[model samples]
Target chain A: MEEGKGEVKHMLLAKFKEEVSEQQIEDCIKQYANLVNLIPSMKSFRWGRDVSQENLHQGITHVFESTFESTQGVAEYLSHPDHEAYGNILRPLLEKAITVDYHPTPVQL
Target chain B: MEEGKGEVKHMLLAKFKEEVSEQQIEDCIKQYANLVNLIPSMKSFRWGRDVSQENLHQGITHVFESTFESTQGVAEYLSHPDHEAYGNILRPLLEKAITVDYHPTPVQL
Candidate 1:
């Protein structure tokens, strides 16, 4: 593992309260879609809500996938006010979650 | 398209500068491993740097995999000072990156 170098992925998962309104849900979905799609290094993106009666994917509010060139790449994305605004909007119902950051060590070199 | 609910995955890709040293590398890897592994709902985890000779994963510092029950679930993870401290240590060499939040909408009710 080199000292100041390596690839890293930030993975996050979140939940919301049960009494959320429909209008707020619509707004969040629309806004989040546009935001994730607009990033330059976002290789791909996906999102949706948990609606399983059996609760197979229970309690999950959203799932996203996007890749950046470097840790700085993620910083740039997080710095956008647009992103912050959405976080503010969704801040109310957020429940339990996790975010892990890591990078691989050089194998052959 | 539900209004205020869905499963979301926060994914991030990062890059760092090329001048990193070895001790810092040890510090980050050990700490990050413990953090990610300790989360309660953490289903799975992965991390690594971009070291492919063919440059397949170029510029990527880390890649992590984890699932949360809700947006709120993620909040708990981010609020911890331990996580934040690592970010502080890692703040210097971080280069470029992107973080996408998403969820799988419940289909069958």
Candidate 2:
């Protein structure tokens, strides 16, 4: 295993407000995608809408995953103006939001 | 946007037993990585240990993310023999487990 290759992954789970239209959610996702391009610390970003209908999710409707070079990189992304703007758009529409950040080490196979 | 390119992403949140050694958890991860290689439906797999110490996770310590071609692909991965074996090993170590599966559409920038 390579040394110091550890990276942080940020996962966000969100449930939208009942009044929020699907179009608005799509627009928010596009805005996030655009924000990723602007944030150098965000190495990658992906978002998805729940389709499994699984009870395990407890009504959480969407998941967003992003990678950063480290925990510091994650903090940088969080403090960036673009991220703040994105949150301003997203927070009002969210009924619930949960976030988890973790450091990933590659598993040897 | 590309037509019919939407993919399913499976996110798993887990907390290990208090008695479970870190080495055992690492071993389970490697086993899972091996299983992903054997399961054709699993396009990608990544796992991480919580580093953020944020209270939002409510003691959840690990996050795993995987991608498949579709929801059907996710089902195939879950039901596959290799996955079952991997779960057999992992379940015993897990104190809590939560999963969410979603379909991700590429956002137009």
Candidate 3:
């Protein structure tokens, strides 16, 4: 890794929305498909998958993945209007929310 | 908040661990009670509460809340031996993992 090369830092927020049907969530997943294309710094993206296969799931709902080239890049991504729009659309439906941030250190290959 | 008092930035990693019994996971919650006592910068902490009273809970397992005064503080907490040890114990059992990070902006209170 170059000594002055920039780093990858990302901040993630997760909220669990209630009373939303699978079809509605699926529709949002599809909506996100279009949203992802608009964000320049969304280096990685994915969603939550069912691990339990049981009919009941309590605390989990949406899972998302994204990456940024620098801390400022993350800031730019977060502050983007479209990104905030996604929040506006999703926030009203959530019952629980959790968030964490990570700065990925480069691995020596 | 002072002009440059510092900021809180935390990275959260969530994974759905499979084949882990509820009792074993509950035991872990007890173990973490001791671990949280060790990390000084952890300003906020809590666990996931069951939103659904149904028989099956598929995606959710453990919910952890932690806080850091600075990014470096978060780094210190993450690299702590106790935290690493927790990872050692829990990694093998995980089936799915999701991670996100957040930087809390100071709000006018």
Chain A superposition TM-score per model:
0.60, 0.86, 0.69
lDDT of 1 at A23: 66
Candidate 1 runs further than 4 Å off = A1-109, B1-7, B21-27, B37-43, B50-59, B104-109
Q: After superposition, which runs of candidate 3 have C-alpha atoms over 4 Å from their true positions?
A: A1-15, A50-58, A106-109, B1-109
* Residues B35-94 of candidate 2: C-alpha lDDT, one tens digit per residue: 778999998877777766345786788888787888889888888999888888888898
lDDT of candidate 1 at residue B21, scale 0 to 100:
67
Q: For residues B1-109, could you state the per-residue lDDT of candidate 1 as single tens digits?
A: 6433534444444566567665666565566556655665434334564433222333555543345677666666666676677668776766754444455442211
Point to the candidate with the largest DockQ. 2
Model 1 error, position B75 (Å): 0.5
Q: What is the TM-score of chain B alone in each candidate?
A: 0.63, 0.87, 0.67
| Deviation in Å, model 2, residue A107 alpha carbon | 1.9
Q: Which candidate number would show the highest lDDT if scored against the true structure?
A: 2
Interface RMSD in Å per candidate, to 1 decimal?
12.2, 3.5, 16.7
Candidate order by TM-score, highest to lowest? Answer: 2, 3, 1
Q: Judge candidate 3 at residue B82 and give its lDDT.
A: 84
Q: How would the docking of model 3 be graded?
A: incorrect
lDDT: worst 10-residue window of model 2 chain A: A1-10
Q: lDDT per model, in order? A: 0.52, 0.78, 0.49
Judged by DockQ cut-offs, is candidate 2 incorrect, acceptable, medium or high? Answer: medium
Model 2 DockQ vs. reference? 0.52
> Which residue pairs come into collision in candidate 2?
none
